[model samples]
Target: MEVIEVKDQDLASTLSNNSKVVIKYYADWCGSCRLFNPKYKRLAKDERFQDVTFLNINAEHNPEARSKAGVSNLPSFAIVENGEFKETIFTSKEEAVVELLNKLN
Candidate 1:
């Protein structure tokens, strides 16, 4: 349940290959993104999310992924299940993320 750093070139392929995927779209300059980093990592390592493929996509560098995920804010979280886009959590709070992951379980 490690988080993979996805680039613009690998975004599509990664999505195509993984069934349950959680992508965190972030920018280096964003303070909120920085703050959310640890939580995101913890989520990836959690046993509950073991089957989920966790990914980190740079919003500025990966426009295609950012647009596909409909990320309008820094540190946006998008979940895809069974090759379909399930939901996008637009909060920086770790609790909200935990809630969403709980729903998946």
Candidate 2:
């Protein structure tokens, strides 16, 4: 699945509507965030993640969305299941993201 770009207005509903979700919080000025875009896309299309919803929220512009993940880094990942925040990791590594995704399965 392609990553869905979410803003503050749609975050709450999106989380509630999806069963399992992985949100990638980023800032436009962060180099690491930009570099991870393609990798995030590849992971979203991963067969193991077929049942998960992938989301992208700009940390700089969406304070409410960032608060969901307690985002403190340029690239942070959070897993939300059944509209509840589960776990989050602050990382720029692809393997770390895979680790986060593992929690859903």
Among these predictions, the greatest TM-score belongs to 2
Residue 70 CA error for candidate 2 (Å)? 0.7
Q: Give model 1's TM-score versus the native structure.
A: 0.92
Cα distance off (Å), candidate 1, residue 81: 1.3
lDDT of 2 by residue, 21-99 (tens): 9999999999999999999999999999999999999999999889878999879999999999999899999999998
Candidate 1, residues 15-84, lDDT tens digits: the string is: 8898888888899999999998888999899988888898999999988888888989988988887767
* Model 2: ten consecutive residues of lowest lDDT: 65-74
Show model 1 residue runs off by greater than 4 Å.
Answer: none
TM per prediction: 0.92, 0.97
CA lDDT of each prediction against the hidden true structure: 0.86, 0.93
RMSD of 1: 1.2
RMSD of 2: 0.6
